[model samples]
Target: MSNRFKNLIVPVLAVVLGMLVGTIIMLVTGYDAGAAFSALFEGAFGDIYYTGETIRQVTPYILAGLAVGFAFKTGLFNIGVEGQLIVGWLASVWVGVAFDLPKIIHLPLAVLAAAAAGALWAFIPGFLKARFRVHEVIVTIMLNYVALHLSNYLIRTVLSEKSDRTPNIHDTASLKSPFLEGLTDYSRLHWGIVIALICVFIMWFILQKTTLGYELKAVGFNQHASEYAGMNVRKNIILSMVISGAFAGLAGAMEGLGTFGYAPVRGGFTGVGFDGIAVALLGGSAPIGIVLAALLFGSLKVGALNMPLEAGVPNELVDIIIALIVFFVGASYMIRIFIERLSKKKGVK
Candidate 1:
């Protein structure tokens, strides 16, 4: 079989095994797994509103997956995606609310503010890693906490008028679309989905069709060799992180301008950043794969909400299934070996 076909087998098996395990668990716990799954499917796709909402949920996941996957592809573990996303959301909302410009200018400015803020936030760790030999993971983890508290402080002091959230962004800066809303029963779907799709294509093109991409991937494969081959290793490292952060920032912009229309003081992580790790892994860091993985995750998340209402099953059961799927993906090596064994058996016949 072709390598691409073989590559597809791992995730397919992982998802199947995850669902099978989830069913077994439900049965063992005395719940009707069939009804639960049926509800899930219905919730995800039965109605136009639900379908639109699922797509809305998917929008951020796509950008977040790109953020994490791009970094991983370039040999960086950007654990700071949450921190970067938080700052991006804050920056985007700040610009959106602070400005009074034409829609053509204001919207792009807010979105660019988000991307710039995320890139700036990520640059710190990237610089440290490149210059001081610090681990990006450790720095990024610490930055996540710093971002959480700092954003809250800024909200209470700088961005808010004694309120916990910023004011709603001007309509000119908003991504919310009345036509899309009407089409989907007033779902929060917006133009960010188009931007996310564009970004996916950009990433694919950058990595597959550009000299810069070749250098970046080369550095990722072997930093010393890439340096020896006359590539600016440190520069590529920082650039990769910055680009990854830009995508993460756009994810935040989706929430601020498209979903909520304002930036609220978050008491904790948004969870989207962390979930990106799973999405990236399952997608094998490929752009198209990331989109597909995001859709699956988005479906599960939106669908899980109906579990209790329709089937009397705890929604957290879906979380378990998601975790199992990630676990199986993490065990892709084993799955590949199993496939190879089966191939060998067939050959022997």
Candidate 2:
């Protein structure tokens, strides 16, 4: 099979295997697997409301997945998406609530702040990696903790309102759901989905059509070789991280400006950033693949909330299924072998 065909086949098979495993687990737990699955489907796609919620949930995942996937394409492991996301959230919210401008100006300004903050947060690790040979994975991991604490402190002490959250943002800064009135009750789905799609297209264009993308990929494949070939390995490395961070920041801002309307005190880590790793893996780190993967995860998350209420299944079951999918995708060689063996058994010669 062609490489493209294999890439598509692997993720599809992984998902099928994950569902089969999930079904077995459900049966073992004494639940009606069919009923549970039915409920899950209904909750995820049964009605317009559910579908909108799934899209809303997936919007951030798309951005976060892009952040990780983009870095992976350039051969970098960016564990610091969590930190970059937090900083982006804080910066956007800070601008959104602090300013009193018109909606057009305020919203754009907040978005810009988010991107800049994320880029700055990512820059530190990139600099260390390019200049001092410090491993980006380690630096990014450490920065995640720093960002969490710093963001918590800022919300509680520096920007806190009477409540634990900042004030509701200016009207102009809010991303109202245009389809909400026409659809199910009050879905949070907004224009961010469009923004995410645009980003996906941009990522594809950059990676497949640009010189900078070629340089970054070269550096990722082999920095020494790229350098020998006259590519600026260090520059590409640093630029990749910055671009990755910018995407992460947009993910965080999507939550703040698009959904919440204000920055709440993040009591602990939000799983969005970490979840991006799974998304990137499941999507095979391809732009189109990442979008689909994010949508699937988003549907699962929204549907899981309804499982207990409608199917008497634990919400944690969804997490288990997700973990299984990620595991299968990561160890796809086994699946590939199985496919080869099956193909041989069905020989038509």
Candidate 3:
């Protein structure tokens, strides 16, 4: 088999194996595994409402996956996507609530603010790594807590409404989709999904066709070599982090403007950023792959809610399945080895 074929086979097998394992777990727990899966499918894609919800859930995952996946391509581990997301959420909400421009201008402005906030949040770790030689992983992990607390304080002190959320955004700043409403019975799916797709295309174009992307990859592969080649290693490293953060911030904007229309007090960290890690891994950090993985994760999440209500299965079982999928994806090398062995055996026969 060709290398490309093998590459495709690995992820497919990993998913199949993960699902099989999940079925075994369900059986051991005395629940009807088939029923649980049937409920999941029905909940996720059975009706227009369910499908719209699935797409809504996938929107943020797409952005977050792109953020982490882009960073990975540059050999950077951006553990601070969580922090950047929070910053973006706050910035967008602040702008959305404060402004009263026409929809064309206001919506884009809020999104831009979100991107800027996320990029700025990411710059701290990037700067520290580039100039001070601090480990990015450590800095990003620490910054996650800082962002959580800072956002919490802001919402409580400055942005809080009668409820534990920021003021509602102007209708002009919101990303409502009349088309989706007409088709899906007023589901929350909005223009954010379109934005996510556009971003994916842009990321792919830059990575595959731009000099800057080439330099970033070079630096990621070997800073010493990139510098010797007259590339600005420090600049590329910092820029990569900033771009990564921008994508993460956009993820938060999807929630604020597209879904919630306000920033709610996150009593705790939203797990979207961390879940991005899994999505990126499952997608192999490729643009198209990330989109597909995000859809899968989104469907699972949306469907999991139904299992508890319809099948008497615990909602946590869905989490277990997701974890299993991630674990299998991480061990994809094993799947590759098995496929190679099978191919060799077939050739001998």
Which one wins on lDDT?
A: 1
lDDT per residue for candidate 3 within 278-348, as digits (tens), equals 99988888999999999999999999989988899987888998999998988988888888899999999
How many angstroms is residue 167 displaced in model 3 relative to the true structure, after the best TM-score fit? Answer: 1.0
Q: How do all the candidates rank in terms of TM-score, highest first? A: 1, 3, 2
Clashes of each: 0, 1, 0
* Clash pairs for candidate 1: none
Each prediction's TM-score versus the true structure: 0.99, 0.96, 0.97
Question: Could you give candidate 2's per-residue lDDT for residues 1-349 as a string of tens digits?
Answer: 4567778999998998999999999999899888888888889988888888888899999999999999999999999988898899889888988889988798889988988899999999999999999999999999999999888878888887546777777777766656663565667778778878888998999999999988889899999999999998888989999999999999988988888877777777889999999999999999989999999999999988888888899989999999999989988999888877777787854
State the local distance difference test value for candidate 3: 0.91
lDDT of 1 by residue, 1-349 (tens): 5679778989989999999999999999999999999999888887999999999999999999999999999999998888888999999999999989999999999999999999999999999999998999999999999988999999889988779899999999999999999999998899999999999999999999999999989999999999999999999999999999999999999999999999898779999999999999989899999999999999999999999999999999999999999999999999998999899899999
Model 1: which ten-residue window has the lowest total lDDT?
Answer: 1-10
Cα TM-score of candidate 1: 0.99
Give residue 161's lDDT in candidate 2 (0 to 100).
50
Pairing residues by index, what is the TM-score of model 2?
A: 0.96
After superposition on all CA atoms, what RMSD does each candidate show versus the true structure? 0.8, 1.6, 1.2
